[model samples]
Structures are given as C-alpha cells and as structure tokens.
Target: MSLFRKITETVSKGVSTATEKAQQTVEVTRLHSQISGKRREIEKLYVSMGEAVFRGYLDKDLSRAETKVIPACEEIVAIRGEVEALEERIMQLRNEKECVCGRKVPYDTRFCPSCGHPFPEPAIPAAEDPLEEFDRQETEPSGLSSADPFVEPPGYKDPGEAPSASDWADVGKPVLEEVPSAWSDAGQATPSFLDDADAVGAERADSAKCPGCGTAVGTTAKFCPSCGTPQQ
Candidate 1:
C-alpha cells in the first residue's frame, strides 16, 4: 500500500511539471513570434524608406531625398539593434534551460545540463517615447473682465491709501466735486465782486471803462461802445 502511494505521488508530480512546461513553451513561442513580426514590420519600413530614396535618386532630387530618408534610416537602425539584442537574449535563455533546439523553457532557468549555457540576464528597457506626454498645471482663476483689455485682476491690491474719514465721505460724491480748483468750486465761497461792489465803485470809478475798446460799464449792451469788444 505504501509503495503504491509513493508511485502515485511521483506520477502526479511528473504530470504537473509536464503541464507547466507545456504552457511555458507555448508562451515563449508566442513571445518570439510577436517580436519577429515587429522586427519584420521595422524591416519593411526600412525597405520603403530605401525605395523612396531610390526614387528621389532616380529623379535627381538629392537634398529632398536626404531629408526624407535620414529620419527613417535612423529609426530603422535603432529598431534593428533592439531586435537583435532581444533575439540574442532569448536564445541565451533557451540555451540556459537545457532546451532542445527551438524548444521553449521557463524563464527562471537554473542550468543547461545539455549545452552548459548560462541564464540570460533580463533586459532593461530603454526609455523611449513615440508619443509625448506633457503634464500641464491648471491655471488659477483670475477674476478680470474678459471683454476689457485694461481690466484689473481680481487680486489687485490698491498700492496704498488706508481710507480716512474724508476718503469714505468722498466715495458717493462726483470726482469733479472733490477737485479743489478755484474756478469750479468758486460758487461755494462768496466772490469779492458783489460783496465789495460799493467800495470798489467809490475807489476806481474812472477805471470802469474797458482799456482795450473803451466799453461802457452799464450800457445794457454786452459789446464795447467804440470798437464793439465784449466785456469778458
């Protein structure tokens, strides 16, 4: 009974190992095929580029041809190197697994008892970009009027001016009213002319006539008596 149990355990272990190996083989083959297809695509592109160059050469457009072909040539060469390295690494991995020719094995190989090939070191992928990913920072909202070019920003702080009692009082009034010009605010204060008209008449009675045009002071006429110059 014990012997039978031993045999059963051994057989089960063998079956599991065989299944895992089969799966590994399939996955490795798929990997190689995919890589090979990519390599072929790159090769095709290279051929197309060569053909374009050849066409330009035939047409005698050398400079235009160079410009077109150079980038494609560079890409092709870069791809070729990558593909070669990948293939060599795969071959090395298979060899290290004691794998038969074209036979696949698990990647975590220990030793190749058949050919004595060491395990392939994992390839570090080169940082490559076909599409550029730009990370843009979001702008903070600014509360300026969109329609006006000279609109102040929302955060605009007045340079100075802690409002005193006077400034607060002036906010509701017209800007023109706040101005202290003598001509505009003259009505607010009494002018000297009407208040002292009697005194001035007694002092300068002869000077009432216009010096420029000899205009009379009270003729019921705005123009001068002699030359028609108006009393300004």
Candidate 2:
C-alpha cells in the first residue's frame, strides 16, 4: 500500500510540472506577440512621420517639420553615442581594439595586420618631478618690494629735475605754450583766436535755414519766410 501511494505522488508531481511549463510557454508566446505588435506600430509611426516631413518639404515649410524631427534625430544621435561608448567599454574589457581597416586587434598592437596601418602612439603623461614644487618655493621671493623703489622705467623723470627742451625734441614732442590764468593778478585779456571762434559759432547759430525752402531764417523762426511752411 505504501509503494502504491509513492507511485501516485510521483505521477501527480510530474503532471503539475508539465502544466506549469505549458503555462510558461503560453505566456512567453503572448509576450513575443506583444513585442512584435509594438515593433509593427513603431514601423508604422516611422512611415507616418516620414510622410509628414515629405509633405512639409513639398509645401516649402520644412522648418515646422524640423522642429519635431530634429529633437528625435538628436536623441537618436545621443543613443548612438552611448552605444558606441558601450562598445568601446566592451572592447576594453576584451583587451582588444578596432583598427581603421575594420579589423579587431590586440590593444597593444602598433599596426593593423590586415592593412598595415600604423596606430598612433598612446599618450603617456610626462612624469612630475618630485623636487619641482620644493625648488619653486625656494626660488620664489617671499615678500613684496617698497612702494617707491629706485627702478626707473623708460622715459622716467626725477620730480625736482625740470625736463629740458632738447629732451622733448629727442622724443619728437611739441613744447606746450604756457597759458595765462583767467584770475591772475595781471588781469590778462582773453585770447583773440578764442574770441573769433565764439563770434563764428554765434553767426552759425543765428543763420538757421528752413528745411522746406532752404532759405536762411532766424534761429527762433516758426515758419519759412519764402514757402509759408512751418519751420522745425
């Protein structure tokens, strides 16, 4: 009776296992079908988007389509960049690198065996000298110098020494004329050239022309004398 019971339990367990496997297979099939449907939908979207862009091109309004498409294209570019980075990582893990000749070679390979293309030398950073920092600290001066140090720049002059006319001549600089102060004890008269300039400016201001007739008029004239037009 015990042997019979053991045989019955084993058969029941086998049936249960088979049923679970069948259910799993059915689930996997359903998931695969959904994935295929989604892929088809994506393909349809691609076709529709392409048609939209083509319509915009035909209408000569590509900018409207570019607004939508450019972002998607940029995203695709970013994803491709990520994929390339991942591929590089994979290559590094495998201790291999790709050659320009489209062949995979060992990372340390200097040249492509397939095309004889020479690889660029790997950049080895220059080693820092351990004493360099110490040497710099020792060579640099510790403190700032005096405010009025005796160092003379080019064309420097002493405060007490008056510059000679010959010194100005050597540098092709004109010697400036000394002007009489307005409030001097001597009571100097205004320069004649300055007075003449003021008179010329007053004459120009008084001789305003009418834009309508081009006729000369007073500076405060409201109307043109010849054309009866309002003056600006």
Candidate 3:
C-alpha cells in the first residue's frame, strides 16, 4: 500500500511539471501568432506597392522592399523556432510522466500494473506535541526521584493485597536464614489424627519439618539454618 502511494505522489509531481510546461506553450503560441500577423501585414504592403506601380503612380524600389519586409519574415521564423522548442519540452514531459494505466508502468513504479491504488499524497509531518516533549525531558537519567532501599515500584504488589513478610526477606536479602524452633508454636507441622485413615500420611509429612525451627524445610536439611537463631 505504501508503495502505491509513492507512485501516486510521483504522478502528481509530473502533472505539476506539465502544468508549467503548458504555460510555456501558451506564451510560445501567442508570440508565434503575433509574428504571423506581422508577416501578413508586410506582404499586404508589398501588394499595395505593386498595384500603385502598375497604375503608373511610382516605380517599385527593390532596396525599399528588402528593408521593409525581410525583418518581419525573420522575426516570424524566430517565433516559429520558439514554438517548436516549447512543443519538444511538452513531449519530453509527457514521456517522463506517469501514465494513468499500469500496463506501461515505469521500472521505478511501486503501484499496481493495472489498478491505481494506495497512491501517496504529499507528506505533512505531524507537529510535535508539547506535552510529550515535556514528558520526555522529565525522564532523563537524573529524572527518577532518589528512593530508599525499602521503597518499591508503584505496583510492586496489587492494590490492597497484603505482601507476605516471609517472601519479602527471601527476596530482599538473598542469604536469609530459616526460622528456628523457638519461633514456632510447635516443633513441627502437627499431625491431625482426627482425619482417621490419613493419619500415617499426615505423620510422614509432619516428620519432614526442620527439627530445630519446626518450619517446613527439605528432608535433607541438616539443621534449622535460615535465621541466625540456633537449631533446637
């Protein structure tokens, strides 16, 4: 589509050039017409002079004839030459211009070979938005306000959603220690025997708790290790 538009723009430019050439054509035509009228006027004068001599009014002067008529003829010829030059310019412009049909499209054309679509119009760049420019100016390397380590991005957590304290320590301090047994109400995740048939399964899960902190840790954890507090 963009390609077609560009071709249309090319054609428009060609048309404008042709319009200028047309003005030249009109000027040339007008000049030629004036020159032709002058030539005819000189010929009439010659005829009148000949008639007067035939009637015995006076003798025909060859020198006078040359002086009066030759310059007019020469001027006519010069005007014709200008007309021819203008004609040639018109033809050249036509050949260089884009055709309405696509079949004879030039090699540089971007539009369709048969249909003229997606023609490009002259581009008028959009004016820059004042607010946008101002916003951009505000966001340079020194734009951000100085913030404390605890300060987070505006949407660090969803609105009204409480953040887990435990997760914060893990993320904030990469080397966080685990909770000790002294920190837990029980030494481990207590079993619920009231669930009856699942008692053994629950006990297995409970036993996997860290012995020192009673916090859940992997079965391979040798001792409670997250926090500086010692294991039970």
RMSD of each: 45.8, 42.0, 35.5
Per-candidate TM equals 0.38, 0.33, 0.25
TM-score of candidate 1 to 2 decimals: 0.38
- Candidate 3 shows a clash count of 9
lDDT ranking from best candidate downward? 2, 1, 3
At residue 30, candidate 1 shows an lDDT of 71
Clashing pairs in 3: 5-118, 5-119, 5-120, 177-226, 177-227, 178-226, 178-227, 180-213, 181-213
lDDT of each: 0.61, 0.68, 0.54
Q: Count clashing residue pairs in model 1.
A: 0
TM-score of candidate 3 relative to the true fold: 0.25
Per-residue alpha-carbon lDDT of model 1 for 55-95, expressed as tens digits? 88899886767776788778888887777666666566455
Candidate 2 per-residue lDDT over residues 1-232, each given as its tens digit: 4445555897999999999778766665655565556556556556666877998999999777877676656655665565566556656655789978687777876555455566777899998787997899888986766774677889888899988988777696577765544332446765558878999789888878768767766666555445545666
Clashes of each: 0, 0, 9
Model 2 segments more than 4 A misplaced: 1-49, 55-63, 125-232
Name the regions of candidate 1 deviating beyond 4 angstroms.
92-232
Error of 2 at 62 (Å): 4.3
Compared with the true structure, the alpha-carbon lDDT of candidate 1 equals 0.61
